[model samples]
Target: MFMRGKCIGCGCCTSRCNADALLYTGEEMDADKVLDEVFKDILFYRKTGGMTLSGGEPLMQYDFSLKLLKGAKEKGVHTAIETSGYYPGKLYEIAKYTDLWLYDVKIFDESEHIKYTGVSNKLIMENLKYLNATGSEIILRCPIIPGINLTDEHFEKIAELSASVSSVKKVQFMPYHPLGTEKMKSLGREQKYENCEFLSRDAILPYLEKIKDKTDKILEIM
Candidate 1:
């Protein structure tokens, strides 16, 4: 609902909603519209059990996120938020509506985190700890960018962090892909990581070894 960044802004999601509750606001959509569309699959909600709120970063638009989440809860919709855990204050406000928190732990080192994501990990780390303390169910998601933070040391750090957090129910590793390459060209933007290869099992196993026994944790490669 808190729309920011260069999304395709396609109304595909709105059209798929059977509830007839979705509306478009052009370049910027509304939280109300998102809630409406999501609730359309109330029957599916009854079956699968919840709705997810995710975007470029829901925390980017704080006020709308709070209102959107509160509205969803009032309607008895089980809620989850997928975020990078980069904004603590906003994350705290939305924690109440969140039944599950899908958090992306992108990088281990602060400097490298900034280099690729153009942001520091200080706030992200703070927010992760806060969410863990707030009793939110957490799934730690990691995008294993090929040339960035793909070392044994980085995985060790990640394992330590995962073991330290009592709320972390799982750790997911996602390898880089060229899925967004054409999108960059279509959008008139240059690809920053054209030379990087997708991570291989051989390349990843060593890193995983460094963190394997930190906890009896669920380690998945996707």
Candidate 2:
């Protein structure tokens, strides 16, 4: 489930949930509301052992997340978080309650990350290392933007970083897509990367294979 404020109110979740499990509440949700909704599928989740916490950034609501994770653990549901590692010491606190972490590493270079995401990589990288040190199961997610970070240099840098991290379970290379351009227009913000193109799956395969070939770690395309 996603929190409200940073959400831009995107109805993407409702549109994507084919199971009809997701609905727009049209309101800011507290821990109580989130738990009530999740518990609806407890029987099914207990059988499959699946549950995830994703967001614009989950760590933004630290206490709420802590409660959710604790509750999920008590209910025997596997907990996971999808986040861009920008928060301070929250990683350590959340690690205690979380089962797995989906860490998004946008760009290796600081300036490029700032240009694209309006944030620097300093804190993000630091948080990743901290999570690794804490012995958490972490997956590295990198969005392969054609003009931005899809070059050979960036790929090599990512390989090197991933190789050094012992806690990383897999490295995923995701191709850029224009899926958010229209939303930018609706929100009245200029889409700086609108003209950017998505690389074909064929074109991205070799680069991904090369990165995976460099190390024995699992390489995934997402």
Candidate 3:
């Protein structure tokens, strides 16, 4: 049911849909099937590779996500999740099986976050704090959305959180990429960051310098 994935810009499927209906994309896979797929690549997981549950917010499907992490852990495979931190799921239980948390820090200001993402950042902030308290190994994946959240206050807080949170293993700055723009256009829809240019490492250096002094944690631009 998730539409947030790979789409070639063929435009063949664009006209198939009716008025704003949900796209019938992404095959359904139960936890066991998914684990089977994950295990197929177990050889690569010898050192660096592992299972990461991503989403339109994986916590939205609490039962399936739980089953997945539990199964992966039982088989001695590493586990991680990339989450928005916006869902109210059983974090402690998920943390028990998860080896790392790739938590997104979209924006720092509450009003601005609500304006941009259509929700308050209260829950995200709360869950992040709770996760840190649980000693969950975390990577703060901060995306620098152009013309929206790329601000001084945002960078400063990213540094502060990186330095203060004992569980944060690293602060990763994700540059803006126009990967979704073409996919949206092919689907006869418009994206918010349409026409935005991809950011270069040179562009992220200033922000990195801003946070470098405040945080001793490892920082990398992706």
TM-score for each of the candidates: 0.80, 0.84, 0.85
- Which consecutive 10 residues in model 3 have the weakest lDDT in total? 1-10
Q: For model 1, which pairs clash?
A: none
lDDT of each: 0.80, 0.82, 0.85
Please give, for residues 130-217, the per-residue lDDT of candidate 2 as tens digits. Answer: 8889887888888888888778888888788888898888888888888888878765686888879977767788787667767656
Q: What lDDT, from 0 to 1, does candidate 1 have?
A: 0.80
What TM-score number comes out for model 1? 0.80
Please provide the root mean square deviation of candidate 3 (C-alpha atoms, Å): 5.8
Model 3: per-residue Cα lDDT over 1-222, one tens digit each: 436356664544645756636345566789999999999988888688889999778899988999999999898888999999998655888889989999999988899888878899999999999999888799999888778767788888899888888999998989998888888786667476775688877888888887798998999998
Which candidate has the top score in lDDT? 3
In terms of lDDT, model 2 sits at 0.82
Deviation from native of the Cα of residue 202 in model 3, angstroms: 0.7
lDDT for residue 40 in candidate 3, whole number 0-100:
93
